[model samples]
Structures are given as structure tokens and as C-alpha cells.
Target: MSDPWLPSLITETPQAGFELAIKLSRMGVKMTQPSDEIRKKLRVIYEDDADSLIAASQVIAINYQTVAAANNCWR
Candidate 1:
């Protein structure tokens, strides 16, 4: 099955992408939202120059500070 969280980042605007990133980060997933310049770089690396291709963030799995908390402070 596809990842449910994928839609939260890609199917919406930049602000929503930011929120999703934070939410995932709180869950210990380190993610980075690609800026315009970074998008250009990714296009180069992936060699996908499609105009409709949206840049996806790089998510690294690891234990982070936010996830170490006993409670969800983001709420």
C-alpha cells in the first residue's frame, strides 16, 4: 500500500508541506522540504526535467529530539 503521509506533503501547498514535515519530525522522521533552488538540483540528480514534476522532501528515519518527549507538545 502507498504511504498515507505522502499525500499530506505533495498534494497540498507549501504551508501544508511545512506542517506535515513538522508532524513527521515530531514522530522522529527527519525531513527537508525542497526549496526552489534545491528543486533545480534534484531535477539534475534525478534527471527528471518534467515541468509538472513537483519536488519531494528527503526524509531520513532516525530518533529525533521531538520524539524523545513523553508527551506530544505540538498539540
Candidate 2:
């Protein structure tokens, strides 16, 4: 089945991504560096506006959920 959480991150905010990453890390999820282009996109989204932080947080939460679900599914 397709993961529902992955798309949520794409739609969420950067701060959300950070928060989600933290939560996932606590749950033993590993993180890898995003590509330069991806990083550039993230920077553009976050650096340009303060209100976008909420979206960032949502992205993170979705990412965390995706990771957790994937791990569980594999196990």
C-alpha cells in the first residue's frame, strides 16, 4: 500500500519537518541528507516566510508517521 504520510510532508512546513525529525529520531529513525536541490527548495520555502512554519511542522509530523509506519511494516 502507498504511504499516506509521505505526501503530507511535501505539503507541510519546514518547522514541522524539524519537529517530525526529532520525534522520529527519538523513535530510532535514521536521517540522511537531502539533495542540494531539495535543501534549496526547503530554504526557499522557510526563509521566505515566517507563517510557513506551521506547514513545516506538519511536514515533519507526516514524515515521522511515514517512517514509523514503514519500520513497523518491515518488521
Candidate 3:
């Protein structure tokens, strides 16, 4: 149910859309995926950026992995 006191336009706005991903108020705001053209453009723009970020972060991931000796309790 919508609030009767609210402006009518606010309630009607969402129906005009292309598509939405999610709408839960708690998890986060909704997002729409980029269209094919935009997705290609974004991939071109960020591919190098992603490679650099991965290279920058790889050492931390390597450092953070556990060096656990096998726990033989179950055997």
C-alpha cells in the first residue's frame, strides 16, 4: 500500500522503466546493468584499470592465505 498523503507521481514513477536488478531497501539501492554498447565501452575503459588493481592486490592475497599444516584429528 502506498501512503495516501504522498504525491501521486512518486508512486507511479517506477513503471516507466526499462528494467531493474533489485529493489530491497535494506541491501542497497537498485542497479540496472549497462546496455550492450555501454558494457563494451566500459570493458574497454576499465580492462587496464582492472589489471592494475589486480596486480596491486595480488601480494595481499598471497600473504593472507593460511599456511595450515593438515589437522589430523579426523583421521
Candidate 4:
């Protein structure tokens, strides 16, 4: 965990920024869980759950907001 995946939040475009946000969200989950087997088991439970899906989307949206702000809204 010493290496850094987020050296900077800057992106060339909004699409890339959004992708980064998704990556950040995913990384957050991995950091929290840190177990591929358990994550897979949990994914089976949450995959078809609409509420869980929406919650995941919300986390991505929040991460996007942070990234967008860091990029100055790409303005």
C-alpha cells in the first residue's frame, strides 16, 4: 500500500475524469475489504440488489464531484 495510484486528479477530459472517479470508488472498496474471495461472495449478494447498486452509483458520483472540483470543472 505504499505505492500511490492517485498521484494527481487531473484528467484530459470529462470522460476520463469520470473513469478515474469510478476507479477511485472501486479502489476505495478494495482498500476497505482487501479480500477478493469475500468481495466476490458479497458481490453475488449485491449484484442484483437495486439499493446496493444505487448506493454504489452514489459513491461514484461523489468521487466524480471531488475529481471535477480538482480539475476546476475542466474549465
Q: Name the candidate that leads on lDDT.
A: 4
Q: Which model scores highest in TM-score? A: 4
Consecutive 10-residue window with the lowest summed lDDT within model 1: 60-69
lDDT string for model 4 (1-75, tens) is 748888899999999999999999999999999999999999999999999999999999999999999999999
The residue-by-residue lDDT of candidate 2 on 1-75, one tens digit each, is 324444433314545555556665433322344366766666676666767767655666676666555445233
**Tens-digit per-residue lDDT, 1-75, candidate 1:** 334644323423444445555567534412343366765665476556443232233331221222322123323
Query: In model 1, what lDDT does residue 13 have?
Result: 43
TM-score of 4: 0.97
Give the Cα lDDT of each candidate: 0.40, 0.53, 0.32, 0.97
Misplaced by over 4 Å in model 1 are 1-8, 29-75
Q: RMSD for each model, in Å, please?
A: 13.0, 11.3, 17.6, 0.7
Worst 10 residues of 2 by lDDT: 25-34
Candidate 3: where is the Cα deviation over 4 Å?
A: 1-31, 50-75
Which runs in model 2 stand beyond 4 Å of their true positions? 1-50, 73-75
Residue 66's C-alpha lDDT in candidate 4? 97
Clashes of 1: 0
